[model samples]
Target: MESPSDAPASAPSGTTPGLMGPATILPRCATGIEGLDNILEGGIPRGNMVLVAGSVGTGKTTLSLEFLVRGAERGERSLFISVTEASSKLIQNLSTFEFFRRDLIEQGSLVFVDLPVIYDRLGLGEEELTGEEIDILIRTIRDLVRSLGAQRLVLDSLTSVCYRIRKDEQIRDFMLRLGQELNELGCTSLLVSEIGPNPARYSLHGVEEAIVDGVILLWNTRRFGDILRVVQIVKMRGTSHSRAQYVLELTPIGILMAPHLKGGREGGP
Candidate 1:
């Protein structure tokens, strides 16, 4: 397997990566988030959705943000929808991450939406979506995607939508509709999911993992009084990726996936 940096710096014209190199499609944009795109073969398929699952403080949001912001840097507009968070609060929290800034969010390149407000105003129970409601919700999202011509998208925690709506059927139906909508609109989306503590059983019911084209699991463990982070390519549909769980770190530079196994916990205060 070629190192990410070693792969050809260009994206293929269309349809696939070098034909048989991997089952997953190579990324058109280098996420700017480290080691991730490598295990993902190149990156998540151009318009496909991926669920980034992990526990609290595991960096799922940060990674997703980096992915979207990186897209902006590449001249691709991006969108970030937080169903459970207020937009102002979400932006404030992200501002402290390595590569986040208000300037980017206000520049029309990285648009943020507070879905919690929308849902609250609608009084929509978890899983309470009727066919009619879904139609409107999708249309709104599509409007945002089209208006921005967004090439990348991030949903802070899609599974929470299940909790808020309290219905699996609705979640499933909405996701199916949303996924197709995103694909048709050419938005590469990262759906953040809060995983259980165990690294193996990261996703809640595996639906999120199953629905998307790829799944990246992030885990953290304490060793010698230091927190060590690890990321694994649980699955990627179109590319041949490294099966190993590599070390990851969140430093002043954002998320970094160290492929070399560097033998332990990353240093930071």
Candidate 2:
């Protein structure tokens, strides 16, 4: 995890960076989104695993994919761990995004590990994954992360790993272990979660939220019978950020942020 006051990747001043190397500054990866990066104090701290939580259809996948693409554009190795989607279908779905680059996938700058391959071996259903299965799954995940030299990792949804074991205690332990392991690898990570009816809360009713370094909540507020979609940064350890929710839209250009420029002056808490 990055220290609370770690210099932003795009540090504003021209002062020498506090990197360990003699005059060699630390490398920072830029997330492609403009307003989102500003909210992150210039992007998620390098080498920390973050959790993005929301109900189904809450742009979790879209946000994560964009993070991977942003890192790839900056020449940082990236990897996506698909706990639910198939390798082919995963690629097919992301292929529709104009921001997604095929060469990045072909050249190994970005790679995806399909958990279903192992889940099928254990016979776990789509929503059911077991601790025994996860133990087996972790080995494969660890191997792939090393082989690809990935610096950015995304678990499409940690909820699969949570329910696989069928016990909340086991899920908590798994989340802690996963968070610790990801930190040791020095890879920036994002874990997705499916929220419940209480959309205002940041975490699911489990341990995934407790272990993550930061948490982002994607939102859709129904006001005056109108559905307004938004994304907000709820918790980011060691950094200061705007708690307001920014109106969000998905377009051919990519995900758009509606801040003050939109018809609303305020966002979310």
Candidate 3:
């Protein structure tokens, strides 16, 4: 791993060394993923809205699931709002992971809800949501988080949700209010962003990334005749973390990461 000095030299005073090697000023909501937490300094600062941006097959959903599962293991109530897949199918896929505990769902520590179901119930049937409808959507999410007392939340793909929110201004306002609602409830959130490879921006609407508290970017690249998944912290609000890129692996146990060293066999799987 790279040294902590590789982080920003302007890190604020009174920030303490975190679980890994970096420093943070606020309480952390640890993802508990090997190497990732290390890169995050410890974990995401509590109540932060982090954008997990990546192209397809870049392990975005897997990483988000692992984040929720790990949080649930620590006795934190976790919620997953799936936009593309059914909750049952997600749980079925999650069962293959060694670290996954099905009982966590049965025990109600981890909960999954389909965003489509919520939309249907809320009567947000239009392709483009009105500003008033956007408020309803945000309130619905806030209510779910509050009712579940979810300490950690994951939205499978923010792109899917934003597709219905066409205007950049509306998307920005929605994110701002939703983030404020979650932060007020003490919930740390991961909002997945599906983008084309090498996107100019991390989200469907460029403004989505700006409203977020942090951005963890993932993408695929060719290296030594092999395709590799790479991850990096593009931005994080309250922590001094490594901006270095790392190789990401999606394993049966869970997500793993290692520093992306050029021509080094040690990091890549």
- Among these predicted structures, which one has the highest TM-score? 3
**Model 1, range 154-257, lDDT digits (tens) per residue?**
98787675554445566677778888988888787888888777645545665556677878788776666877777877776655667777777777678877
Compute each candidate's TM-score over C-alphas: 0.81, 0.81, 0.89
User: Against the unseen true structure, what C-alpha lDDT does each candidate score?
Assistant: 0.70, 0.71, 0.85
Question: What ranges in model 3 sit over 4 Å off?
Answer: 1-24, 263-269
Best-performing candidate as measured by lDDT = 3
- lDDT string for model 2 (1-269, tens) is 33332354445223332353233223334466776776665666666678898777768888888888877877778898887887678788888989889899998888887877756765766765566766666666666676777778998777766655677677776667776666667677898887864655555555667778888888676766977777878787645557877877776567788763345544443
Better of 1 and 3 by TM-score: 3
- Candidate 1, TM-score vs. the true structure? 0.81
- State the lDDT of candidate 3 residue by residue for 1-269, as single tens digits: 11122223333223346455443246677787858777666678778999999998999989999999898888889999999899999999899999999999999999999999988998888588899889998999999999999989999889999998998888989999999999999899999999998799999989999999999999998866889899989999987788888888999888878878776443311
Off by over 4 Å in 2: 1-28, 120-133, 200-203, 260-269
